[model samples]
Target: MGTAGLKALLHRVRYEVLPAKSTEDKVLAHVPRDVVVTVTASPVKGLEPTLDLTARLAAHGYRVVPHVPARLLRDDRHLKEVAGRLREAGVDDVFVPAGDADPPAGGFEGALPVLRRLSELGSPFARVGVTGYPESHPLIHDDVTIQAMWDKRAYATYIVSNLCFDPRVLGEWLARIRRRDVALPVHVGVAGPVQRTKLLAMATRIGVGESTRFLAKHPAWFARFAAPGGYAPERLLTRTQEALTAPSAGVAGLHVFTFNQIAETERWRRALLDRLGG
Candidate 1:
């Protein structure tokens, strides 16, 4: 990709944040309003924190998206209330996830059910997103995950892939998605620039089994960050340039897993923007 293309991809990058205390304020206070901030849900607690953070962020005039975990919603009334609250807050988008709850707290089993129910309820959300895995999930078969995404395509407006370290795998998997006629605009997830120790800790806290698989998928990357140094988000971004800019990839842009390291990630992105001089 050329400088202009790369700039376009980086300029409007989306940042995903957790529902931790003071995290929303820190992000809103420091990061540019241009960056779209998405809030994540915690299975242990439920969707309360996510929605609370979303409403606050929206009130602050920031473009915010909250993760709506299906397992956390108790029933249709719950879903309706959630939708109403978000809509009243001027929130237009939401990302639905199957969730990591041990056992669902409600009738909804997974993202598919929630998506269907939302559509049936005449949901107020303008854009709905679902997850995609570039690598195999530790708990589910790779084929099954792909097919699940395809089945959910009718209800989803876009796809946000989980974090993956290997560029080759990300490229090949996305290319395959394009070939299969699953042409949803994909916001590929990549870890933001963060120190190795904190990065791994955050990865564990997020419970992305793929994070461990990422290291196994590329020992060299693991080795580089295993010691005292930091991991550069650019290393991964530079490697997968083709998958991002290629038309066949149907790539939308970045969905950075900042892991609440908003300042660090924003610095990296700003430097890159200056370097590109656009």
Candidate 2:
């Protein structure tokens, strides 16, 4: 494939950063102001930390989007408060997920319900994102995930696929979405260059049970770590080049899971951009 398409997509790349300690410096010093920064929420720490980071990034003049896990929210009033705060923080975008919380924190049962509530309350965000599982979820059936995305189509501006190693699987899933005429543009979620250990740790933190199932299902993905240096997200992106550039695919851009390894991720991105003539 020509570098033109890859170059174009690369220019639109965004970063997803978790709220690890001193992540602010990691992002601000490494990631450029032109890139859209998406802050991720943690079930352990809840929503505030991610929102706080999003606000900090926005104040520094970057386009900021934060993930709002439905399970972390307290109530309708809490949702309204969060919306207001997000707007105040200059956040124009948000990504909602069902989350890995043990039990319901409040009324929101899932991302779909949260989307509905946001719409009902006059959504403050311009671009609201919903998750897509290109690979089957560990617990939820593939059919349910597809239906969830279809239902969320009414509210979501776009879909962000979770980190999946297999490009072929992602392509097929994207095609399936297109077949259903669920036209939400997809932002491919691929991990940036981070230690294999950190990636596994992240997986466990997100959901140990799901992580085990996920690793088991994609053994090839896990096996790669045994012999190599850290996983290179570029390889996955390159392998999915056709899917990414296909007009019918509606592959908007990339949503890189940086995992707070900002310096390395940014370096890799810039290097690729240089090679691709970005």
Candidate 3:
């Protein structure tokens, strides 16, 4: 990384997880002490587990940002309880995304309702993150997604872009966000150096529809990865560097989707950073 690039990487790094059994220890063991680590709330495991994991991670001195999926919350009462738990745990940051639950859990179907409630309760968090889709979501339209982001900006401190393989798409999206004057700093999402076979196997065991939706958005990437010689994350990171170098780019940092390949991911990150003199 260049001098500016190194500074950006240091400031923007974040690790993600699904709050699986033993994930807390796994995350703590492999993730770098300096990077902000985020535990995600999956539909299967629910938010409580992730919240508890966040508290434990916070106690251990890591800056933990847990995902608060909107659909998982039952109502305002539940939201207040969740916020209180986080505040007591010294967690001052959260990532709010419209969850993937089939039926609406309560009155809130999307992030705006939950975000509004959090704001109303006088949330103690210093940073509240909202999701951004650089690629098209399977269900929601692009216009609705953009408008939802705009609507939630008042309650959000930052925007974490959903996974996108093409850096050019990210660059264009950043330009559009700036053009629209949506100034919240962006944390670009990238998957770590995971083997193609491993990724595919994991995806199958998880859910094929979800995996298909992901692959649909990045056909070129899937095709490339499925080809001979397999895939490497360096291609993605190199493109990321190019995108971040653009003048006045609001790219704040990186949110790496480690997919529980924590050790290898960190190793790849360190090696790349060293190569860039970071």
Candidate 4:
């Protein structure tokens, strides 16, 4: 892709934020209204925080997508209420992941069920998103994750890849999905400008069960973030520019995992856009 195409991608990107006490203020203060803000559903806090933030952001006239993890919900009635609430709040998009909740809060164990339920409920949301694992899921086999997407293809409108640092892994995963005919437009997930200390602190609060298992699976996470001058998001983007922007890739846009570093993330995005001449 040329710089123009890359610039357009950077200009229209989604910022994923964890639901925290001061997150709303930071988002209102730093993020542009045109950019989509997604609220994450924390296993510890459950779905209320995610819904609340989504409603607040939507009220402010920002397009917001809330993470509705299947494991966090209780049942179909609860899903209907949640859908009704989102509709009333004016949200049109949602991201559904299997989630980190252990033993689940109810019968919903994976995203497919909730996704199917959403469709059964007349597909209330305009855009429904499912998780994509470019890297191997810590617990689930690689084939299983790919198969999960195929299973979810009927219900989900798009796929948001999880955080990944390697371009090769992302390319290979994208290839596999395309081969299997899972053609949903992908919003590639990348980490935003993050400070090592804050990243570590926030990881703990996301959910103990998932965090612990995830840390064990990717032991080098700390070292990568702790490296000299910290992790540079641009380097990854630069390397994957062509693949991501290719017509055949079916990439929708970028999904930045801000990790609640909203202000820093906004700053980094602006600076990167400037460098890209966006």
Q: Judged by lDDT, which candidate is best?
A: 4
True lDDT of residue 36, candidate 3: 91
Residue 115, candidate 4: how far off, in angstroms? 1.1
lDDT at residue 199 of model 3 (Cα atoms): 62
Summing lDDT over every window of 10 consecutive residues in candidate 4, give the lowest-scoring window: 206-215
Give me the displacement of residue 232 in model 2, in angstroms.
2.3
Instruction: Compose the digit string of candidate 2's lDDT tens values, residues 172-229.
Output: 9999989888899999888777777766665556422222334546667666653466
Candidate 4 C-alpha lDDT tens digits along 1-278: 66766787788799988777898999999999999998888687789888998999999999999989999999888999999999999999998989888889999999988988888779999899998989887788999999999999999899999878888888888888999999999999888878888767755553533323354468676568867775799998888887888888888889988877889998998898898883
Summed backbone clashes in each candidate are 0, 0, 2, 0
What TM-score would every model get versus the actual structure?
A: 0.90, 0.91, 0.90, 0.95
> Per-residue error at 173 for model 1, in Å?
0.6
Error of 2 at 73 (Å): 0.6
- Candidate 1 has an lDDT of 0.81
**Alpha carbon lDDT at 146, candidate 1:** 87
* Model 2, TM vs. native: 0.91
Worst window of 10 by summed lDDT in candidate 2: 206-215
CA RMSD (A), model 3: 2.7
Model 1 is weakest, by summed lDDT over 10 consecutive residues, at: 207-216
Q: For residues 218-267, could you state the per-residue lDDT of candidate 3 as single tens digits?
A: 66766765666656767776756766656666777888877767788888
Per residue, candidate 1 scores C-alpha lDDT tens digits across 1-278 of 65676778898689888778879778877778888999887766678888998999888888999988888888889999999999999999999988767688888888998999888988678899999989777678888888888999999999999877778999889987776788789998987886777656754554332234345455565566666644567877877887778877877889987767888889999898898884
